[model samples]
Target: MTIHAVIFDFGGVLFDWSPHHLYRKLISDDHERQWFLDNICTQAWNTEQDAGRSLAEGTRSLIEQHPQHEHLIQAYYDRWHEMLPGPLSDGVAILEALHQADVPLFGLTNWSAETFPYARANYPFLRCFRDIVVSGELKLIKPDAAIYHASLRQVRAHLPDIQPEEVVFIDDVAGNIEAAMALGWQGIHHVSAQRTAARLRELGVGF
Candidate 1:
């Protein structure tokens, strides 16, 4: 199928998405850090949050279950801005090139509703896309078929003839890429700008 659209993951693919920055800033102890990541940063808790659990409710649940680590809850809430440094200039250039080529661009991201506006302000390139599907807003996160379906639906509503195979979804996480591929969308595990550009070129998406 001729690729007609490109879906980009915001965090790692387009921006410097580092979870450890907040993790290190919050949890000082090494052992406690590992434990917190294992328990809280796994797919389950994130999936629950994406499934409409309020941030306060989710944080409260974690605090209640892991009372020993309750102090870290507020820190997690406070440090969201630390995740995004700035837009990856090279990646943004590629996205702009795609847009110039008249290819539809969309975003499928696992971002919290609370932090999305701040990110949008910081990265103007985010607004360039035709469609933006955020997990927190939809109450459905990535790797979940529902969210992917929702993203596709949103884009299709705008451009009725677009097909799933014609959409290229890029994410830094392997699991997200796998999930998109499973849904019959072209998926790219973003490593570097060179690789991303190469992939797009191979797909006949001119830079």
Candidate 2:
């Protein structure tokens, strides 16, 4: 089927975000920092917040579990802004090109609702999307069919006639792309702006 719209994943794709951006300064020792990230501020733990656990609640629960690392745990969200340096310029350029071409755009991201507002305020390019389906707001996350269905609903709100096969989803995670493909949407596992752009071009997207 012909691609009619594009859905973007925020972090790692368009936005440069990583806990190491903040933890590197806090834990100068490379091994120690890696340990903290691997054990303390784990991706699985952070994904809980992305899946709708409130920052306050998740922080308090984690601190309770690891009282010794209270300060570091609190710092995860308190200084969360440090994790995001800025947008990935190359990907943003592609988005701008697609916008200029008048293709419908949407965002489907596994981001915490509380922190998403900060990103929205800082990134002016987010306005390019007609709508964004945030996982935290919906209590869902990527690699799960539910969120993709929710995203399709959001897309259909603006494009009443769009079909599942006519939309392309871009994400940095392989699992997320696989899930999208399983749901009948074209999936692009975005490694770089160049590759993503090439894939879009192959799909007959002018931009």
Candidate 3:
């Protein structure tokens, strides 16, 4: 079936967000920085917050578990803005091009609802989407079929006739792509805007 709508994952695909952006400045030593990311403020731990745990609660709980790294734990959320510098220009260009073409656009992201306001406020490009289903707001995360279904529900509000086979889902995570594909949606594992744009063109989505 021809793809009629596009779904985007925000963090790695369109936004340049990384804890290393902040931690690199804080921890000079690469080894220690990697260690801190691995053991202390882990991806899994951060994902819990993205899945709807409050930032304050997550930070406080981690601090309690690792009292010695209280300062670092606190800094994780206290300086969270540092982790996101800006949008990826290439991806933003693609989004804008798609917008100009009047293609239906949507967002499905696993981002903390509490922190998402900052991005929504600062990033003008986010306004392009017909709707964005945030995992944090729904207390669900990527690779989970529930959140994908929720995104579909949101999309159906505007695109009542859209089918899973007619939607293209773009995500940086392979697992997220796989999940979407499982549900009969076209999937693009976005590694770069150039690649994603090329794939979109191949799928006949006009710029």
Question: Once superposed on the true structure, which residue ranges of model 2 sit more than 4 Å away at CA?
Answer: none
> In candidate 1, where is summed lDDT lowest over 10 consecutive residues?
42-51
> Candidate 3, residue 137: CA error in Å?
0.3
TM-score for candidate 3: 0.99
Q: What value does the lDDT take at residue 125 in candidate 3? A: 98
User: Could you tell me how far off, in angstroms, the CA of residue 100 lies in candidate 1 after the best superposition?
Assistant: 3.4
Task: Provide TM-scores for the models.
Answer: 0.87, 0.99, 0.99
User: Model 3 residue 24 lDDT?
Assistant: 92
Please give me the total number of clashing residue pairs in predicted model 3.
0
lDDT per residue, candidate 2, 97-204, as tens digits?
A: 999999999999999999999998999999999999999999999889999999999999999999999999999999999999999999999999999999999999
Q: Point out the worst 10-residue segment of candidate 3 by lDDT.
A: 1-10
lDDT of each: 0.81, 0.95, 0.95
- Please, what's the RMSD in Å of model 3? 0.6
